[model samples]
Target: MKIEIAEHKKLAHSMELDVRWGDMDAMGHVNNAVYFRYMESVRVEWMRAVGCEPSPKGQGPVIVNAFCNFYRQLEYPARLLLKLYVSDPARTTFETWTTIERLDQPGVLAAAGGATVIWVDFPAQKAVPLPDWMRALVL
Candidate 1:
């Protein structure tokens, strides 16, 4: 069964993850590219939670823009707590914000960024307005 948006919506969706050795660069800090992977992981998890999956036959979400900023060096063996929220919903796209914090340090921010996600019909290769369910998930 399809679930509607919660009456009382949460500000954001979050999860905790561990920094992997492979995610680091020769400099011993998390590589610049790895932050995006972390964000992608969170987004994919959210999609599953909200019952949206990418399929060629129907409308699926795609990231049209992605960005991140490093506040500090993220090393392996550290715990990362990440949060995601939506802002500025448009007809075919919405902005998603992400906050990456080091769980061990509590309030210390490791990085932050967001992406503009566009809903599209894969077979037609064009954009489509956000579906009701998808809007609910973002809001």
Candidate 2:
């Protein structure tokens, strides 16, 4: 399904990454699955930056759902600027959205996507209320 970034979404993070040759498929474009990886990379980076990295013995964010919409083909040898946004913070979950654009062609969307991230207690294998700090950041 296509993910939409709402107008109220807060811009949480952004970063640039190079598209590797290995990310291309037989069609000579970046593989569809690679787009998800691009989204994941930025998500993880943002989480880490906010000191929310998952812990095996503690609580952290877990992606319960994810999606992307490819607007244009992405090719290797390009620098991508991925901007992530967060919104709709609930007791146990929040939403993250990302827009991927090529630096050489600024403001052109190559892909856009996001995930429904729920805070979870790993040891208990269940959802938990978002931490106050996390909620503040997402709000």
Candidate 3:
């Protein structure tokens, strides 16, 4: 059950991640839990790259939900190329999708996932409308 990525969609960000030895599990493949960490790294990096850093007293994005589908087992000593995309921007939320592929394997998909991101007022702990600049980026 691999997630489909649109062929014509523009990617939000792309980065490489090294699969560390510690990421392996007793079964000798990358642990399922570590995939979520990979997704988080890319998401946070994209947010920072776009100047969307969270401020304790200001508004920022929160991931209300997230999911991932694994199509292939990832082993250690691998470099993964992760591509991220953003879409469906609403007043306070947007969707972030990601594809993980091993650089050594090129086009082969290792996994895919996404998260529903909501803009939140940190102090108020409530949702807020996304800033114009941020909305424009996703659009």
Candidate 4:
């Protein structure tokens, strides 16, 4: 979803995450790793929301790359709205971008990240074409 970042529209399957005490680091704010976890969780949630799940035998989504930028610190007792979207779709992979907005702060961009996910045949240990159904949901 494109956040209120200068007119970009938000996707439909966004999610909210409650910041927990354990999620903070020694710096007294949310840790860097926690943001990635949030993106991963939201990606999984997006998959389920669309009623698509990878089979244990083969077809599944794998993130080959990822990164997050911390625009602001997330203190304890915060709620974040996260959204994910797919771009640069290709035969075997797609780029999933995520944004986190601090709801309490209003329009504050807490973080943004993206992961390159490639569909794969686990048993074959190689890349495979993205299923048409999955592509449909992403597009």
The estimated TM-scores of all candidates read 0.90, 0.95, 0.94, 0.89
Q: Please state the error at residue 44 of candidate 2 in Å.
A: 0.6
Candidate 3: which pairs clash?
Answer: none
Instruction: Spell out the clash pairs found in candidate 2.
Output: none
Which candidate number would show the highest lDDT if scored against the true structure?
2
Worst 10 residues of 4 by lDDT: 1-10
TM-score of 2: 0.95
- Each prediction's Cα lDDT score? 0.82, 0.93, 0.90, 0.82
lDDT of 4 by residue, 1-139 (tens): 2345323323636899999999999989999999999999888898888876778786888889999987888888988888887766689988787889878776668888878999999888899999898776666
Which tens-of-lDDT digit does each residue in 1-139 have in candidate 2?
Answer: 2345678999999999999999999999999999999999999999999887688999999999999989999987899999999999999999999999999888888999889999999999999999999999999
- Decide which is better by TM-score, 1 or 3: 3
Q: Which regions of candidate 3 fall more than 4 Å away from where they truly are?
A: 1-4, 7-9
User: lDDT value for candidate 3?
Assistant: 0.90
Off by more than 4 A, model 4: 1-12
Tell me the tens digit of each residue's lDDT in model 1 across 3-108: 2223343445789889999999999999999999999888778778878878889889999999998888899999998877776668999888777888878767
Q: Give the Cα error of residue 2 in candidate 4, in Å.
A: 11
Q: What is the Å distance of residue 108 in model 2 from its true position?
A: 0.8
The better-scoring model by lDDT among 1 and 4 is 1
In model 4, the Cα lDDT at residue 55 comes to: 82
Instruction: Tell me the spans in candidate 1 whose CA falls farther than 4 Å from its real position.
Output: 1-10
Best by TM-score: 2
